[model samples]
Target: MALQIISVVLFTVFFSEALTLMCYNCNTTTECTQANCSSSCSSMTNHNGNNITFVKKCADSAWCFNSSINLGLIWMSSQCCSSNLCNNATVSENGLSCYTCNDKDCTNRLKCKGGEDHCITATGESLQNTVKGCASKNICDNITLLNNTLPQQHLSSSCCRGNLCNNAQKMTQGPVLLLVPILSLLFYILGLF
Candidate 1:
């Protein structure tokens, strides 16, 4: 009986599996969820020249990419790995540079991280604040759709290739002065679904 008990205890200890991992979940209120994930990680990017990050615990075989979801016009860049609470850190940088400023002239410099290869410039009718930053090509491609998706006021976006292409100043009164794609993406959250 003693030997049997020992064997049973050993088996239970060896076969017991961890229930779940703690993950930082984004919500209106700060919350955490026990998730079945081998890794926890975050997605990071410059939005209107400011860094935006989202954290989530990820399953196995996860990879990273900057992708746009048309349903809610959700643009996401996610990086995943296989470690507990691994998503807590900032995503790796992608070595791209662009001029950046928010609610002001584009005088500040921004570091483009992840899959953001295109530089974006934007101005809105109501706010009249010029926003500049780096973005994925998809966000730059469908400016009309983006505007329509988040329409309370008129917004405009211009996307350009090459480093620091958005560094130049524009005379707002002239159409000929506007260059590249401007991303007024935050007219409000697009596709809030």
Candidate 2:
């Protein structure tokens, strides 16, 4: 009975170890520590000019993919691997250039990296601030779909292809667009009188 119990315990330990994936986990400049999970390991990196930030952790394979956001002076990306302890830091090169905004100035150029293929211009909820950058088609599509479903859009965004296509002035509808219908109605009422 003693030998049988020992064999059972050993089998359980080996089986559990085989089922778990060990990954490196860390953030920014921190040293990586081993972490266990059932999914793949990921390494995410952000490059802002000369500065670089790196993160490593275990993540689901379904959510892992190479993606990037380019903000002229800054860029970010994420990568994933399935093998144990395979989350090595890696930086992807930007292939396209686009206009980006900083404060009120939208003249700066940004390199679009990873899977980004579109130039994006977005306005905040308050409409007082605008941001321009490079984004993946997935991000642009989801933003468009979400905006179309809202009765009153809290955020407005536009996406275009080719370099510097987003350089055009703010794309959000202004108060002037709202005044058109009101002005037309007033003209019809006055003409009737």
Candidate 3:
């Protein structure tokens, strides 16, 4: 009887762990349709990675930061949930709008240049050693700055963005289906004991 109970507990733990692990690695393709300016706007991928081929139309002399831009297609790894996990991801800089993961660090940090141009000060004086005119192009740039400047930085692009938010949805199907039967059997055996 005790052995049966132990088996049920073990099965429950194993099922939970497996489900958690699977969920960690699961990737869902969420469409940013609202950001799509035109009917032709569509995301595509190649051997490299995901790409946002469409470019947002720039209005007048004002350079459009492409706030509608797709930052990058991030695939959350199995270790994403843990504290020591490699949350380090990537972002696209070029028109392709993609990123690559070599190690754990995000390869492309500079996306749009933020429309800020840093030039040498005219004075060339020792007192004017510091570079100036380094300001953000968008409100989002301020958030990125905060992430870089702060110590305990928890800057997640998936957080604020609606619809595309990766909130770790529960697995309604897949191997979890197998776990259900196993769990039921374990419970039945426990009850018999």
Q: Which digits, one per residue and each the tens of the lDDT, describe model 1 over residues 1-193?
A: 9999999998887665463444555532356565554444443322222334344545344334333211011234444444566555554457777776532345556677655778876666755455566776655666767667546547676778888887755324323122213222332233111
The superposed Cα distance between candidate 1 and the true structure at residue 136, in angstroms, equals 2.4
Per-candidate TM vs. native? 0.52, 0.62, 0.19
> How displaced is residue 112 in candidate 3, in Å?
2.3
Look at candidate 1 and tell me the lDDT of residue 20: 48
List the candidate numbers ranked by TM-score, top first.
2, 1, 3
TM value for model 3: 0.19
- Locate the minimum summed-lDDT window of 10 residues in model 2: 184-193
Residue 41 in candidate 2 has what lDDT? 88
CA shift of 13, model 3, Å: 2.5
By TM-score, who's the top model here?
Answer: 2
Ranking 1 against 3 by TM-score, winner: 1
| CA shift of 66, model 1, Å | 3.1
Model 1 spans > 4 angstroms off: 1-34, 37-54, 58-89, 150-152, 170-193
Q: Write the per-residue lDDT of candidate 2 for residues 57-110, one digit (tens) a residue.
A: 888887676555566655555667888898875455557777877656677777
lDDT score for candidate 1 against the true structure:
0.51
Give Cα-based local distance difference scores for all models: 0.51, 0.66, 0.24
